[model samples]
Target: LMVLGLIGAVVLASGSLIKAISMIILGLLLGQINTDVISGTPRYSFDIPELTDGIGFVVIAMGVFGFGEIIANLGMPAEHREVFTKKVKGLWPTKEDFKEAWPAVLRGTGIGSLLGVLPGGGALLASFAAYTLEKKVAKDPSKFGRGAIQGVAGPESANNAGAQTSFIPMLTLGIPPNAVMALMVGAMTIKGIQPGPQVMSSNPTLFWGLIASMWVGNLMLVILNLPLIGIWIKLLTVPYRFLFPAIVVFCCIGTYTLNNSSFDVYMTALFAVIGYVFYKLKCEPAPLLLGFILGPMMEENLRRALLLSRGDWSTFATRPLSAGLLIAAAIMIITVILPGISGKREAAFQEAD
Candidate 1:
């Protein structure tokens, strides 16, 4: 619970506090749609059998990020839909650019490496945190959201580093730290490979090979991306009218295939509408996603802790580790809500506007 609170605080600091909290509350409510684990009774399932198993992550993700974005794009005026097709003179960075970027990259990597190990911390969280850190520490904070090289370098480096390190929890403890890692766990299960500490000893070859492949993959990306930049640029020239329909079709196909259920497709459409509402309200959906993912886990752990303590309700504070975590969470919330910090946060966001 404390970890989830801390994560929520970080997310809250990233944007408008009231909007973040509202989205998070909505996410928590949505997470309650399935059956209760402890009571073996239906929760907010509305007597629907299809909802008893809870909503799939893919459904929500595709609905909000895929269809919702498409809807927003379609709603905009045609004048706002112009693609940037300016010719590029150089693909590589200059020496001065490298010099400026390296320090940010190093800081981002360090931050990402640390955060990726935490439950629910992954590329998204790491990148957000890194960007916020860069903005806060920058000599001229106004440069952010204005083609600042530090803003780009920091977040990209953190994203890559966090993506690599997020495999740690899945590999060592069989606990996926993020959605991608959860998919990786599913893939490993299909391959008849259990993810845990035993894998290192029992399947050293597979374990070590996976680690080594990351380095190879990174090298391959650099080699391929440099030459493929033009192709990517050309892709942007495609009209939204031509591109969006294809994307919407693919999203529908993907959602329907998840369980071969038409209900899932309907649910996705519903959430897409909800997502569009959020978009209109300028509410970031990322924190809501984090809440949805962590909500059940937090409930389960809280229940287990209480059961073990015979419902004393003091186990959380009585334990040193949990106490420390709660303290940290409190400190983070206090820091974000302080008058001076809140004012600066608003100012920073306004600058971005």
Candidate 2:
């Protein structure tokens, strides 16, 4: 599934398959840093204690998506770098917009709810999947990546639904599905509330309260943000010269505070340079990020399966579910790589350009 997401990102988001693949490889290499979880041996730590623990996702993400983008924007011509400061009107969607968006929202919500329960599946993956699914199902797929209403509605809905459903595993099974849930688990522990099946019966108030809070929080966001849209838009009017520095400073501070380590700050800076290089190369970082997240999990699961099968390589194909997924992946790969389909895909994506 992760592989499929990465491939889709490369195909849909990044036009250059080779560049995206190279970035994914680079991410996989970076993911190899720190001690091997299975063998307890360091792979790419270079004898540094900080590297031994592996790089934090926050460091990579902030560097790549935040700092890197600032750098990219700074490099662009002044005219090209200007923010969209046009006058706003019609904050509400039209009836036709709702008609088109409702179906997409429903599909996105269903996809997100299902994916969110899986380990390592969260809002990011769900949003990407939903967006890709929308493109796949759209009457004129070329309308995507432009001003398509479905593009915005589907991903936003998916993201919210995925975020809400991600708590299920954490609350019911005492397993944190993602980093946020891990923090929630810690907080619950600190509060003397044990997570798991017993929590619903033993601490019904907390369990039910949390569920109720989700709905209330959603309503609060809608209430607060709708009125504040103009204010949010006004922020874009701020000069890039002032805005960029503040963004960089805050991001550095946030990265430093993540582990209270200067090493992470330095790592973030290093990745920022890498991200800038990626920007110059026109290589989309999203697939790389996905690869980095999924690489370790893939390795761990593969090792576990091998261990269970006593080193039998055929174990993957021997299992019906695993075989089906593998076959599906293979078909997707073939479909994307075929000359006829690849040419049409390129032409379709070219419309966005």
Candidate 3:
């Protein structure tokens, strides 16, 4: 899974291998700086006691995206507003649009199903890859990003499919592919339930019930959204001052509920400021959250693998299957530097991004 994810990143990078390498190094550093619970040592705590617990992923995400989004929106002039269609029209797509979208949706579903099984691959990557694939396959690729129905339908379907299949790894293998699945694992642990292959055999009702709920949830969402879309649009038309405070209040409540810790609330406030700064600098906060969530797990696994191999670093490359995956990832990275391919890859990404 890691190899697959690395290959995806490499392919996506085009000629930007240096940037990819730096981002990885940064993630590794963040992971290492986090406190090791078993060792009870803080690597980058900077003599601050609050740092010992390490920064929470939920806090950072809320701060960077939730609060930061509100802050950024608030910075824009109040009179500036989103342009919306003045009239309400039928929700269904036209016949030509439907025809174009169905094939894209089917292709997206297939792509999402395959990628969702990989660790670290989730709805985001599935949507991204699907959109890219759709653009590549489209008869009029130039239509993408300018009210392209295929662009919307393909990614939306892929994300939904990816989200559903992501549960497979979590339920059957006790491995979470993303942060949400990690939370699901924690929730299962809290309920005195172990998640794995045994979950299906030992608790048939719970397993089947969960599976049924996904369909029910999808139906409910469609029914609810149809009526509420107008209300949502109306809410979007509301002034930022009126809306952002409500968002901030909800974020604070959610942050405090994490451990009922006022300290977390305070930390969230600090991160809100940091998030705003990042927003002003046009920096992305998503990778930091990913690093925070995946870092410790990566470190723990690396440590265990090394210990099992008696500290022999060659184990990663010595195994046949492992070597093949590594070689594939390496090849993808190397290809990004090739002359014509690099230019075209960069152009594709530049268009997409």
Candidate 4:
């Protein structure tokens, strides 16, 4: 819960720009923050000379690994790519398929538009919820998870639509819709733009231009992804000997761009090693990312809540919403721990269906 709260705080703080770069840099550092499988343990300490709270580790790792990956990709021969680069499939969705997709797209758009206004909204959530809703809303519910066209349409559209709309809050209100947006806010602040409702009033060009660009960007993504999806799929079919280097190069370019420091590249390589190790060990990386990203902010919020309650422990359980959230957390924890116990509840739903 503490880690979750911290993640929430970071999400609320970081608005939706530079999501890619931050994900690369900060993500790597998070891998180093606490190697322990479990968070909130006193086993880890912040006494390391090089790792003063994991941010440096993240930056360094990002630079090295990202650059290394790019270098590796660049090393691949074009002649070798020719062996696998077959002609791609069609660029457009069929008219019948489009008909199947439109409703899901509409619903997803509605959900994303609403979610976009809220701070800390995530594209993944919008996508997942849209997917789940589509599953429920479909006439043939069983067709989903089996390449149903609507399943692909709604969540894909919603997540993209949500991602695009999330910029509105950052542009209009100066409040970040997510961590990426928060970084954008930082960049804007650095550029002497005070974000608020008045942003439109003061700089109609920036506001409107950005809005226009999003639609343009969507068009661009379609043009790019349609041809590239075939390519992406093709890459999977290519020999592993060629693929691993491409992965290394992609990581390197993305990571090195963070601060242009070679140290950051090396740091990224280090994290990649750690990530590989984690994969081998069968430990979950999701929680680690959540913990490292949210740790500092979580501590701040906990202290603030404590202050509000005059250091009373009961405050967490006393507030109506807070108490409800806590109860929900407990339910989630127990459900994950003992899913078998909920077998009857699951069967009841199946029977209801």
Candidate 5:
């Protein structure tokens, strides 16, 4: 009991510290610095003036990072001897593939829609959970990871569904689901809008209109993706030589536009380089991203909870829910590294072989 208490305390402290640091670093990277506090500090220098409010982070993250990935993906030589360079398959799902995937799609959508409403996490978790669920419910249970339709369908639907529905709690309740929500609130504040429980009652049109637009936008996405599927398929058939450079160029331009500073372009390229290294290392970026986003909130909560507890440190364990989560996290950390860690994954791979 004593050892568990100590381990919990250390783990909680470390996680909170990391979260605080990440939030502060991300805020700086995105230009969310409040100058009033820093103006008096002689050592502090405002790097980018345009980052006065910090909304540019999402645009750059999406546009520039996305473009870089597209470019790199295009660079894998066509007809070359590389896993990522394999020839394109039939664009339309084959009958067998469709038969396998249809059920997983339905299941993933149902699970993801609910997970997205939770105020504490992001679509990343929803996607991971979707993948896990698909594997469990699969009739054959061996169709995963080998160009399985369900593998693609479940995560795609979950991520997309989560993207739209995540706005439910954010806009209506004014409680953030993830870092993006926090950034959205920051953006709203810049626009002279206030968020809270009353905002829904006070601004019915703004709230309802946002919700309505999401439905319309989702419909448009389906319509656009349907006709354009063929075009995108044709694009995949094109050789890598022409496509790769274009991707790199677009990413560079998008990154540069964020702060209108060349430094950010360089910074983006640096991260891209790191991304490629990570690709080689087989390190998952999902956790890294989640860690980065959660880093700040964790710190704030730890401090607030502790201060309220008068530094008792027992508050975390004293609260039933928090204690339960902390224990689960400990068990997960232990299980992830044990020999059984890769048992299922290895079995899956052998089946693939």
Candidate 6:
């Protein structure tokens, strides 16, 4: 938990979502190599039998995101609570607000669509990036944390676009970018459908129908959610003592159902304590969850790439596409290190209001 917590701390400190994600991938790859193929001996196992099977990503996610959220919320003071004001504003945006928001939504949707195609890039990253991008482009950036219209419109559109496009990789390329995609891949298998390029040709109706359904579902969600917005706002005003326990119970039940294992529940409790410590230390858990998911998969792919390249390290730099991606990654890292870059980034988030 502590190791994962450290990863999360680094991710939050880096101030670049993409940079943190890439680092998590690299870290997972590092943790994944368990055996020396030539020597035929366990390499990072430290003689622990459980280490051979590796850590469970589900456990980590439940601990970091599920329990962690509960702990963090518990630590917050009552004065920090946010409540909806009784003041009435029209449901529709003003003309100036619409003018500012429409372009932001379009840009966010485009960014979300493009990034959602990449492995490990999905709705969460897209939402964060979209919000950051909107703030960067806003004339009065100080209005953001203070209920800026662009902040809401941009991220909401980006998240929707990302949620839709994230399926492209799994449906077209047989690659699951995140855990949800992994589940979708399982669903395809259960339906006797191969998830690849042939899926489009062999299951054209299912493919096109799924795409059409996304549009219909999106429309329906808007229609359904608008009326329920007031209900959700009311939920926010519920006392923390009552609300937190309900959240805890739901999480515990969900975790138990994951494998019908009481061990998982116990582990969640342990993680909740760890998460509370993290809250006290002011560390974030998002990166840790990302790392926990990517670690084993990254190790497998890295090993395969090395084997295919005959262990040639230069393979990464020699391949045109790989080289280009590496260069882009390097530039991102350089930007993070340059003076004032980190400061300005933090300032944007700090001055969100």
- Candidate 4: Cα lDDT at 352: 32
- Tens-digit lDDT string for candidate 2 (80-147): 66566577677677899999999999989987896677666577777767886787667776676556
Worst 10 residues of 2 by lDDT: 5-14
The digit string of per-residue lDDT tens for model 4 on 126-202 reads: 66456756764566655764569888888788888788888888887787968788987898789888888888888
Candidate 2, which segments miss by more than 4 Å at Cα?
7-11, 85-87, 96-104, 128-152, 186-209
Q: Would you give me the overall lDDT of model 6? A: 0.68
Reference-based TM-score of each model: 0.80, 0.86, 0.72, 0.55, 0.64, 0.72
Per-model clash counts, in order, read: 0, 0, 0, 28, 2, 2
Regions of candidate 3 where Cα sits further than 4 Å from its true position: 10-24, 79-163, 169-209, 269-284, 348-353
Q: Say what the RMSD of model 2 is.
A: 3.1
Which runs in model 4 stand beyond 4 Å of their true positions? 1-50, 53-162, 168-173, 177-193, 197-212, 227-238, 281-284, 337-353
**Candidate 5 local Cα displacement, residue 243, angstroms:** 0.1
lDDT of 5 by residue, 207-284 (tens): 888788878988998888877777776665555667666666776777677567776665566557655554444333
- Candidate 1 wrongly placed segments (more than 4 Å): 1-15, 86-89, 93-163, 174-206
Name model 5 segments beyond 4 Å from true.
1-78, 81-95, 103-111, 114-121, 124-148, 176-214, 337-353
- Model 4, residue 99: distance off in Å is 9.3
Q: For residue 148, what is the lDDT in candidate 3?
A: 87
lDDT by residue (tens digit), candidate 3, 1-353: 45445455435432244554454455456556557855777879788776677766668768877887777767887665333325545545679988888998998898788767656546766776677567656656667646688888888888888998999999999999887999999999999889999999988998999899989998998899878767766765555667778888988999899878877788788778877986675444544444444567657777888889999999999998778878887787678778898778656655644
Scored by lDDT, model 1 comes in at 0.79
Superposition error at 211 for model 6 (Å): 1.9
Candidate 4 lDDT (Cα, whole model)? Answer: 0.58
lDDT (CA) for every model shown? 0.79, 0.81, 0.72, 0.58, 0.57, 0.68
Candidate 3 achieves a global lDDT of 0.72
Please state the error at residue 233 of candidate 3 in Å.
Answer: 2.2
Q: Candidate 1, residue 287: CA error in Å?
A: 1.4
